[model samples]
Target: MRLIISGGGTGGHIYPAVTIAREVARLSGNCEILFVGTKHGLESDIVPKEGFAFATIEVRGLERRLSWQNIRTLCNTAGSVWNSIKIIKRFKPDVVIGTGGYVCGPVLLAASLLKVPTMIQEQNVIPGITNKILARFVDKIAVGYKEAEQYFTRYKPDQLIFTGNPIRPEVMSAGRDEGQRALGLDPNKLTLLVVGGSRGARSINNAMFEVYKHFSGSPHIQILHVTGQNEYNSIVSNIKQAGIDISSGGNIIIEPYLYNMPLALAAADLGIFRAGAVGLAELTARGIPSILIPYPYAAENHQEFNARALERHGAATVIADKELTGSKLIATIESLVENPAILSTMAEKSRESGRPQAAEVIARLALCLIKLQSNNKR
Candidate 1:
């Protein structure tokens, strides 16, 4: 079996496509999978390292503001469609699947034009430009949230499926006891896990630093903050200047990033982070209660929508980006940490939103598309 999986710009899009590819290969032996991503995207570095063969086309997202760069980007994007057509012609796969990013726009357009069976997986509550355009021609659409369905009402209902977002297997395999041991965290003290998205959120880092002084002397609760690699140095330098010792703090452990986040999430009593689709999915799957601060600048303010999906379910609390201050954040954290009953209740509600089998469902749909396409040829 052969398939082309396209979609990638950030880790949010790249990781899910990689997870789906791995699952597809595991279930169907001898499957040939190829990834299509942009030359400027992280996929160039990420895909090859995973040992998957992939091709890169030059593509750029549209500029929100009026500028000459917008014109250049528009021309480049048009060129990308032609480039994608060449890739489609050479690979000639049985099916094409896109995970929803700007890169998907050109490739899925090429797939649709060629009359190949195509599928798209949307990870956010609000549809992105790529998914919105490809919805017309794709044979199937898998979504993480049921709320996303209305966005594609123009399409036939049969085209959309809510399969949830596929998470890394390592995330599912982690256990609470193992999590605590790996991080040398105490089993008794209330532990809060703070992570920005993969690249890190500067707003979240700033808020944490502002309130960290209050926790300096507290022995009742501990903090594990992942500053994200890009912002790590500045965050660390600022903390050191504030006279807050990080190395042996009795109640705090701050680092740039956690390579084993699944373990950290498993061990956490509370989580504070941005509400990207994967971050929310992992939190829900592990039943980790969180204070979600959606990225203020996301296209269509979709992060807020993603957070509300959990907040309405009683799984999380939402703090608007503009309203997140040290005092407000600390107040929210103390309220949850001081009350184990409330935390437990929230954890249960978080689990209620988790869809652990989302990857399996998407894989099944991919195979179904392949089979349907093959039988049509017969």
Candidate 2:
């Protein structure tokens, strides 16, 4: 089998594409897979590291408003379509899959035009502009949240599939004890994990400083904060200036990044982070309740929609980014932690909402499509 998968820009898109690629390889060792993404996207770094064949196309997202940049983007998009056609013709993939990003626009569209089977995965309740446009052309559409269905009304019901967002396999296999030992965190204490995506959010880090200060000397609860590389030095300096010795604060662990995120997620009793679709998927899969602060700048305010989906399921609590503060965050954290019953119920609800086998399901669908196409050819 041969497959072409494309998604990029943010980790949310990149990780899902990688997960699906991994599943495809696992299910069919003989399969040949290629990933197409923009040269500047995170995929350029992540895909090759994961050992997938990688290709690049020159593409740029359309600016939201009229500008000289928009003019250049238009020209680049046309060139991207031609480039995508060339890639598809040479690779002759049986199926092309797009996990959602600006890079998906040209690649998937070119596949559709070439009469090859194409699939797209939408990772948010509110569909991204790229996926929304491609929905009309693709053969199948997979969505992380059920609410995403209404946005793609142009497609037939059968064309839309609710295969929850794909999660890394390691995240499901890692155990709490294993995670605790990996992070050097206390096994007996309640663990709180704070993350603001991979790049880090300034507002979240700032609010977290207050939460850290309040929990500084607590022996019953431990905090693992991933400050993101960009904010780590400044956050550490501020902690020192405030007279708090983070290094000696036995209950707190601060790091610029958590390279072992599977361990961190496994160890966490509670999560405080942005409501990116991918992050939400992991939290639900782990049955860890979270306080979601949606990135207010996300296109179409989709993060809020993703957060509300979990909140509605009783798996998470939503705090608008604008409303987040140290006191408010700390209060919410205390409320959930202090109440074992509420925490347990939230955890159960999260598990109920999780789809750990989403990658497997999507992989099967892609394989099915490839099989059908090959059979038709024969």
RMSD per model, one decimal: 1.8, 1.4
Evaluate residue 309 in candidate 2 and report its C-alpha lDDT on the 0 to 100 scale: 89
Off by over 4 Å in 1: 65-78, 246-248
TM-score of 1: 0.95
lDDT of 1: 0.88
Estimated TM-score for each candidate: 0.95, 0.97
Model 2, clash count?
0
